[model samples]
Target: MQVFEDWNQKVKKTFNATNPEVVLTVSEAGSLLGLTKDQMKLYVDKNKLTKVPIMRSVHRYLLLKSEIDSIVKTR
Candidate 1:
């Protein structure tokens, strides 16, 4: 099985290189991380999270589901 960082790299590359259609919105990402929307936004602003810019003033954060799951498991 792939590690979280490896999976995150794959997803980031897919977004930046292939430009996929199914990127997660901030809200969706927050749900995965067990974080509130505001907290997620804070992480985005701090560059702790990766957000892909899809269109004019529109962006979505990319998060590995496994990474979030790991966080929940550890917590």
Candidate 2:
């Protein structure tokens, strides 16, 4: 039964396509960059990072995972 459950989980993951582009929320990205969420917001604006805007929300957005990876690599 445990093995079956594990296999089922794997199958579900394979079919799940919720995050096709991979994104990080403000808090998540901020933690990675050692900044507070508000500080991160300012950094995003100052750096002109790509923001994946949420539907009907002007202030909420997600940052591209690829961009964050590149920033990490450079630093």
Candidate 3:
């Protein structure tokens, strides 16, 4: 699947489509980046994706869609 499509599916599966700009969960981000869970965590640790804290001790990532679109184009 295309990266954007994959990302949308992941988001829907993991966290319902409350909003497109809504922060994606880690799993969704991984799918978007085409990375494994471990790699996704590493990217979080390395600050590749901006981390945003959520309620009840959960966290989410805010990814720039434009930035991702650029990467997709290059690939």
Best by lDDT: 2
Candidate 1 positional error at 34, Å: 1.3
Tens-digit per-residue lDDT, 8-73, candidate 1: 445556675665434555666677767787888886677554455533334444654444555568
| Candidate that would win on TM-score | 2
lDDT tens per residue, model 2, 9-51: 3333443346667677777788889999899999999999998
- Model 3 lDDT, full chain set: 0.58
RMSD of each: 10.2, 7.6, 7.5
TM-score, prediction 2: 0.73
Least accurate stretch of 10 residues (summed lDDT) in model 1?
A: 52-61
Models 1 onward score TM values of 0.45, 0.73, 0.47
Off by over 4 Å in 3: 1-20, 58-75
Taking the tens digit of each residue's C-alpha lDDT, what string does model 3 give over 1-75? 645566434544454355555455556566788987678779777856555544344444445455555555786
- In model 2, where is the ten-residue run with the lowest total lDDT? 7-16
Q: Which segments of candidate 1 are over 4 A away from where they belong?
A: 1-22, 58-75
lDDT of each: 0.58, 0.75, 0.58
Worst 10 residues of 3 by lDDT: 53-62
